[model samples]
Every structure is written in C-alpha cells, then in structure tokens.
Target: MTLDVALSHRFKDFALDVAFEAPAGVTVLFGRSGSGKTTVANALAGLLRPQSGRASINGTVLFDTAAGVWLPPHLRRVGYVFQEGRLFPHLTVRRNLLYGRWFARGAADGASFERVVRLLGLEHLLARRPGALSGGEKQRVALGRALLSRPQLLLMDEPLAALDEARKAEILPYLERIRDQTEVPILYVSHSVAEVARLATTVVALDRGRVVRAGPAAAVLSDPEAVPTLGVREAGAMLVGRVVRHHPDGLTEVALSAGPIFMPRLEVEPGVSLRIRIEAKDVIVARGRPEGLSALNILPAEVATVRRGAGGGVIVQFRAGQDLLLARVTRRSADALELIPGAACHLVMKSVAVAQADIGEVAQAD
Candidate 1:
C-alpha cells in the first residue's frame, strides 16, 4: 500500500503545508519537534481535518477536500499507536488485545488473533494485566491490539519516545517483525535518527512544517545535503550485512558489500542478516589504505559527494562497494585530501564504533 498525503493547516502561529508519498514498509516521518509530523499522521487517521487537503491509501481516498469527501476517524482503517501504550490499566493483555476486534467490523478472524499474538510474542503475557507489565511489554501489547484491529495502515507517533533506553531496546525487535511480517503499511513519526536508521524503509524528512527530503532510507540517510536537517550529531548511513562467523576473541564478523567488517560480538547466529548504522562522525577518510592503522574495518571507496557545513566541518559521502558511507572531517582536511566526487579514498572505522543499540536484525519475509 502507498500513502499519499497533501495537507495544509494553520495554527495560531504555525502554518503547516506539506505533501509526500510513502511506499509500503515502514515510512518514517522524521524531524525535530513541531515539524508537522504528528499533524500529518492525525490528518491521515481522521483525527484532525486539515483546512484543505487530500489523503488516500492506494487510491482509496479517505479525505479529499476538493471532492468534499471526508471519512470519519472510525471509518478510516488506521490503527494509531501513541507515545505511550495507553492500554487499559484494569484489562488483562488478552482482553486489551481483543478490544481491538470490536473495531475490526467482523473482518478479523481467529487466525488473525493467533497471528498477532505470535508476531508480538504476547502469548506469555496474555493473562497478565498492564500493571504487571514492563514498559516494553506494554507497548508490545499495544501493538498487538493495534494489529488485531485489522487496519489497512498503522500510524506510530513516537511509540518509543516515552520509553527509556532499556525499554526502547526491548521493543525495537518486535517493531521490526511487524514491518517485515505484515502487509500493513506504516506511517511512523519519530525524531530519533537511530529509530529511523533501524526501521525505516523510506524516509520523509520534515523541517518546520515542510518536507526537506524524501526517498529510500539508505539514499536519504547517506546524503550529505541532509546533514543540517537530520542534525549533525545524528547523521549517518545504514549498512546491511550478513553475519559470517564469531571469532574467538569476542568479536563478530559480518560481510558487508565493501568486504568483511568486524564488530563487538553479537548474539545472533551466523548467516543472519543485520542492519548496522555507521555514524558519519565515527568514520575517518584516508587518501590510501593505511598499513599501520588499528581500525579493524577499512574499505576501498570513491567519494560520492562533498558538502561543506556552516561550521568548520565537511560531510563527505563515499560509495563503499554497494553501500554508501559517510564521514565528517574538517574543512581543511577535506580540502587537503582533495575529497571530491569520484575521487578514490578509503574508509577507516574501528570494530567498536558500532553500538549494540545501532545493530538490528533485518526483517525477513515469511
């Protein structure tokens, strides 16, 4: 399913005018606070009617101001997951999930319930109440409930925003499962670059009520021109690698298109595909392959693009094998190294540079 949205709304001081098309899979609406991310989600969910706009899923128009069509919130098959789980405090997990069936309009079947429970790993928590669940567990329950609703689209508005790091870590895998396993398209709103890197198949980056960038996750994240919008500290590239083997010295080896890269040991077995985020600031560029460097990962690359930042740094993109990697270097260094598109170079990165939190399992099709 593809989500097409064109919305215009005016608040007392803020005017939101944005439009974008999101393809199937997890399409993340990313930006800083007050960028109209939630506003778009609300518009699509029928929670808020924009002064003038149009929204549709695969040509099924939910609202079209020009045509005088407006579907009420209940009529729009959108399942919304908020920042908090917002599950009923008194209801058992089973009941909370079943509550969604009430809105399914008899479209959901017994197999749907079983599928959702298993997809979210909720079987063990069925009889427990929300009061007894951890924050991650609660969110998983909430996701199961949403899935059980049998919505055509899912809107997640910073579903991990309320959780601490530990809880966020715990729920991320389950989100990955939903993205890969279900046919439901998702419009996820988040300010987190880590979440975008890990989960997004397509990224629509908004800035102050307008779309600044929109494309596949890899292209958008690897673009140096998006640095200012993505936040300098958060800008990075996503690399997909397959686990080759675990070494005896407590390191895991993964095969990237650029060749073999080593990182801190991962718990997954060999041959499992993983998505790894490589922060631009953590990379170093060399004119040639250095022989004495301690970095475990060094790949031959060619400069893809070079963009100078407002400050003293330059964001350089490199085509490392089939993937693009980024590096932030000083303006002087970039000039001294003659970093330009098509220029030959090498990317140097240490094994420990990849954080455990930045590593995620690649969603697989069943």
Candidate 2:
C-alpha cells in the first residue's frame, strides 16, 4: 500500500497545507494537539473534503477535487479506529467483530476471526458487551473489528489517548503485531513521541499545520537538532544491539556500536537483536573518565554541532560511532565545561531511565 496526500484546508485561526507519502507500513502523523494530524487523517478517510488536492492509495484516487472524484468512506475499504473503542453498546464482542465482516464486499480474504481474536487476546471477553469490557479490552476488540473488515488502509486517530499508562502499554504490543504480522498500511495520528518511536515505520512531523520533517521514524527521531521541540533532555540516542547475557544482579547486557551496556534485566534471550532508546537529557557528559560515578554506560563521543536556543540554553549533538546522541545544557555549563565541536567527551547514562516505549524491534518497512 502507498499513500500520497497533498491537502489544504482553512479554519478560523489556522490553515493546514501539507503533503507527504507513506509506504506499506505504519506512517505516523506526529504533532501536538490542534496541529491538524486528525484533520489530514479525516481527509484521507473521505470524511472531510479538501478544498483542492489529490489523495490516493496505490494509484486509486480516494479524493480529487479537480477531477470531481470522491469515494464514499465505505467504498474506500478503509478501516477506522477512534480514540474511544466505539464498540456497539448493546452487542457482544463477537457480534461487534462480526459486524465488521459485513463490509467484506466479496473480499472474504478478511483477517480470520479466530486469528484476530487470539492476536488481540480477545478470547476471554468474547461473550462480554462493550460496557462490561475493560478499557484495554474494548480497544483490542476495536482493533479486531477493524482488521476483520478487510481494509486496505487503517486510520487510527489517537487510538490510545483515552487509556491510562498501563492500558496504553497493554495494547501497544498488539499494535506491533498488527504492523509486523499484517500488510495493512496504517495512518496513525499521535502526539506522543514515545508511541511514534516504537510503532512508526515512517514519521510525518507537523508543527503549526506545516510539515517540519518527514522521513524514517528512527532517522527523524534521532536527529539531535530535534531534541528540544521533541522533548528530549540530555538527549541520548537510539542504538541497535543484541542481548548478550543476563546476570544474577538483575541486569541485562547488550552490545552497541560503542561498547556493551548493562540495564535492568529484560525478558529477551541472547542473539535476539533489539533496539534501545536512550534519552539525551538522561546523559551526563564528562570531561574525563570519572572514577566513582554510579552510571554504568560510558562511551567516547565527539561533539558534532552546538546550536543555541532561547533562555541561555545550548543543544549539542554528538556522534558515538553509528549512534547519534544529543545533550542540552545551560550556555554557562557549555562554556565552563569547554564543550565544542570535535571535542572528546564521555557520555554517562543510567540504563534505568529507559522506558518501554523507547525501544522495540526495528521495523523493516521503507
């Protein structure tokens, strides 16, 4: 699946004009609230008519104002998953999922009912109604329903926003299963950087309704220059490594471009390659090898770029082998520490600062 979008729409206080394309994987619409992530998604869903532009999936035009082509939402064969579960109040979970099957339109290659039910862990709640299911369960059912509809494209508008942290965690891996195991190209709208990092194959970043950046998720998220607005502190980097071993002290060691890093134990086994995300804000740069620091991971890095921001702050980019790291500090700190481009520094980071959202199996979609 491929998505090509060039859209322009006007509101009372803001005008949205943006264009980008996504391939056969999850393409994330990332920005703060009211930045038009949802607006673009709606336009793609055929729910909102753009003043003038073309939107298409794999050469089939979904909307074209100039050509007077507009496909109804149902005919487009796109599945929608909203923030809330939107499950039928009076129907059982099985019934709701079966409801999506009616839209197959002879394309019965629809995701298997039993396969989807197991993938989403919806077996236990099959007999329950939407009102009786937990937040996470309902969302799982929502996902199952969408998959059963045999959609060529899936649109998710902050599908995890209404849930709490624990609930969000619950559904994220199932989404990963959807992305990796299924071929549906998903257009996902989100404001959470962590969510995008873990789930997106391609990222389309928006700022005030304009596209600030659009590229591979790892490439765009790892750029040192994007830290401040991206909400990275001491700004670390993303590293691809494999689990080497687990120790009795509740630590897991993984090899990186620089060296091996140890963190709280993970469930993964040796030889299983993993992507780990480290925050720049969580890193402490040292002028020399410190003797007694409690930090476990230290790597030599050369300062790449130093840019100044408002409020007497500086953003420094670092290159540690293949990994890109970022650090933000007071202008005074940079001067006193003698930090500059090409200077050698030790990046000291604690592994515990990494959250589950920062890491996942690196997606292979282009």
lDDT of each: 0.91, 0.84
**Pairing residues by index, what is the TM-score of model 1?**
0.97
Model 2 has an lDDT value of 0.84
Looking at candidate 1, the ten consecutive residues that score lowest on lDDT are 102-111
| Positional deviation of residue 30's Cα in model 2 after best superposition, in angstroms | 0.8
In model 1, the runs with Cα more than 4 Å from the true position are: 108-111, 364-366
- The residue-level lDDT of candidate 2 at 75 comes to 89
Provide the global lDDT of candidate 1 against the true structure. 0.91
Pairs clashing within candidate 2 = 233-280, 233-281, 234-280, 234-281, 235-280, 235-281, 236-279, 236-280
How many Å off is the CA of 24 in candidate 2? 2.4
TM-score on alpha carbons, each prediction: 0.97, 0.94
**Candidate 1 per-residue lDDT over residues 1-366, each given as its tens digit:** 888989899999889999889988999999999999999998999888899989899888999999999988998878999998999999999999999877997575323888999999999999999999998999999998998888989999999999999999999999998988888889999999999989999999999899999999989999988888999998899999999999999999999998999998999999999999999999999998989888989999999989997789999999999999999999999999999899999899999999988999886531
